[model samples]
Target: MTATESARPGKRGGTGRGTGTGAEAPRLAGVPLLGSLLDLTSDSLGTYLRARGEHGDVVRITAGPPGLRTELHCVFSAEGVQQVLASQAANFRKDNAVYQEVRDSFGNGLLTSQDEDYLRQRRLVQPLFTKRRVDGYAGAVAAETASTLAGWDRAPDGVVDVSDAMMELALRAVARILFGTDVDTTVDVVDRCFPVITRYVLRRGYSPANFPRSWPTPGNRRAAAALDELYGVCDEIIARRRRDLAATGATGATGSGTDTDTGATTAAAAGTAPGAVTAPGAAPGEDLLSLLAAATSADDAEFDDTELREQVLIFLLAGHETTATSLSFSLHLLARHPELQDRARAEIAAVLGGRTPGAADLDRLPYLTQVLKEAMRLYPAAPVMGRRSVDAAEIDGHAVPAGADVILAPWVTHRHPRYWPDPERFDPDRFTPEAEAARPRYAWFPFGGGPRACIGQHFSMLESVIALAMILREYTFEAVDTEIAVSAGITLTTTGPARCRIRRVDA
Candidate 1:
């Protein structure tokens, strides 16, 4: 069966025209040629908010130039979001141009891959993020959080850029969790290169001009240099791990068709011989790289160096960047509301007494989790999730033609008054067990849903919880700026550095 036929199995509805029957989705009229492009470019969040407020759940927005006009249908209701992300998800795929642009930099990693390749890659990496595996990394996360905060202890003015600091902390933590030994070097490389590459990618994705990366423009050159440095570091790490494994005779540790911690069968694992050289602080089975290195497919085929590098890079980038952004926004929110900050701090003190938090402590700190959830709802790390319809589908009785770009915006839906009353207010109680049970599932999907949802969500939540607990234990944060300027890119960020004043508390 064809994609469109499969998408709409039951009955043919709607007038075959662009607009459907029952309450046609209002289209935002724009300029003669530029259309809604200018409005979208200026302030996407504002534009989405206005469109949803004025036009209801489904709002049709037109952009691009005259002949090549691009139309996007923004779905901003729980029911509609469910249709796009869950019910009829198979009818939609990550064929968006923006996603394709991202693939150029990230390769065919999980975030960018689609169809059979995506499913295969997802299965390969799924084992690494199981709850058990994620819990195992909590100690590393807490340690990194404490170590990063130690530097803040000696700040002369008690002022630091929360965004940059969180990014640095998250980068170090992810490097250790993913690489294990000599992580400082890896973290340094990623920290230096990630910003340049991400900024370039976002710029290229957002700009209307089709500037190829090979153009050798100044921005492209810098991005290329950064990527080369990043890849070089990854190559070095992979080679070093393989050498270590070989020396220890741990190569092929999980032979063909054997179930390992990652729950996948490997053909020729990177084994290490006895008396292998081990780094001073390295612990067995702690790093993801070690696990991946010692793994092969069920068919007895070892992963190539390129494949290894891609997996490592994807984990390093996605593992840290989104968590850092979420933490930054969470901290900003708490700083703005002193009552919530005090409550969180009190909860931390009551829970830990005097010691640092561990994975076990995460469950006990419910308030901290609530705060994080609310913050994510208000300013999701990924403000929008874009998908292109592979077949003609009906969302809330509206016809979505094949190949149309369908946008499911958490930023808008999370704040939609229909689902969340007083949505703009920062109320952690909204996530309480009873309160959450009262709302729809797709109403607040910060990490997304369905089979394609983020696999590392458990890891992200654990890391955020531990980091927030550690910070709240020792320092009281206050916002420096009256208002934060939210900027939307690959991830949500601030226009300027999110600066906050920190006051050290008695231990």
Candidate 2:
């Protein structure tokens, strides 16, 4: 929830458990020893969809051998998801193995930190993502997107792998925002190093036997090398930022990577500013990195050097990858559906013809917003969210054991027949304000809910809306390589190219 929303749980049911009398979740059949390992490792989306189709809302999936199996209690019902994420959130913890891998690689920052650590980090970092501050970064997003469109215009035959393009676009945009004046130092995260580290985390996190990361195995060694390079780069940038602030005798850890502090500071790449980057809608501040460096908790506590590095790492990792997935898939969906594309573009033209989009225009382009929401519902970035049950609980009348690894999958829940009619159809109207209001809160949660929801919610929406508006206005897209495969990584990533042919409206 945003800082503006009330923390009160809306209305409560008698038991809040669904229409059953509390029995163990039905299991999907699997091989004797291996269980569902092959199915999951090969096609996680298909497996989850099939399980939800065969078994009802909650299904227990056991994978691996007898001695070391991984059991996942999948909750695909919107009500059950609400119970896990919002109502009984305290009963579900982020103590899963994959999260541990995140802590090891990125340090115990907000993404991997639990309970009090998470609360403290949230207290210190929440202000940076306030609506006003993030809206201010729309200029930076526009600037970066302009460069991307230029590249697309210059591409041979006007053909491009939009998946790859968006990955580059999102990485550069987020990097520039994260380390404003020193953005060039963040190049390592964009191209070479970060992928290796994430791949290693995915592999080791899912392996039945997670050998110690310190082992001399080839994967571990390679991962270690990548981690060192990433940590060193972040540390260098943070240290330099602190030094610059100290040298200049400035207060609040070098005001947001650029000029004055009152507005969202013309914060872009190290040198994208040519004017006062005024964010006309909300309150304003500097770039997130500087704000993070300068922030103090309620008790006057501040993040230490290492702590600062951890927060920056989490920001970069989470912010960049997830937003890219949303943009890439949105473009893909719009490309394939020309009727929907025109409808959205018509709304965009009506609202923001010549002027660039700002946070204020968000409410004006309702169709475009629905299109984006529909894309997110189809392919949520974090498809399967893992949480361990803190105590034995009854969900949808299913008895969940304590310490069980539970999953809340937006990929499945967004498509639940109960909540979503014509589940496979890509209908933007499903997200119309009225329709959304009629559904359960968790029915279409692209960004997970409750207090632990993504703190970067406003920032993500700001960046995505600005980029999508500009791109849709500038060019028309045709799906070139129409079909693609997807898999679950740190986020949902395309395993193959999603190529699109561009027809620039101006050219």
Q: Give the residue spans of candidate 2 off by over 4 A.
A: 1-21, 253-262, 265-285, 298-300
Q: Model 2 over residues 1-507: C-alpha lDDT tens digits?
A: 111110100111012232233787899899989888789888887898999999989998877776677778888898898888898899888777777777788788877788777877777776666665666677777777877887776788988888888888888788777777556668655467888988877776777666787789998998888888888888887887677656665445222222223345334212123333332222222456666777774464778899999998887778887888888989999999999998988888888766767667677778887887888899888888877776778887788877777887888888898888898788999988899999988988877888688878777877888789889988999998777788877788789889999998777
Candidate 2 clashes between residue pairs 3 or more apart in a chain or in different chains: none
Indicate which candidate wins on lDDT: 2
Model 2 gets an lDDT of 0.75
Could you give candidate 1's per-residue lDDT for residues 1-507 as a string of tens digits?
Answer: 000001000011112234333454678878988778888888877888898998888887877775556678788999998988889889778776566656677666767777877766655665566665566666677678768887996776888888889988888888887888769899888878888987776666655566777898899899899999999988988898888778776643343323334422121012112222122115644477877777655644455688778778777767776898878888988999999999999998888776656556678999999999998899888787787776667788777776777777888999999889898999998989999999999999888788778878888988899789888878888899757787577777678868889998773
Q: Lowest-lDDT window of 10 residues in candidate 2?
A: 4-13
TM-score of each candidate structure, all chains considered together: 0.88, 0.90
By TM-score, who's the top model here? 2
Candidates' C-alpha lDDT? 0.74, 0.75
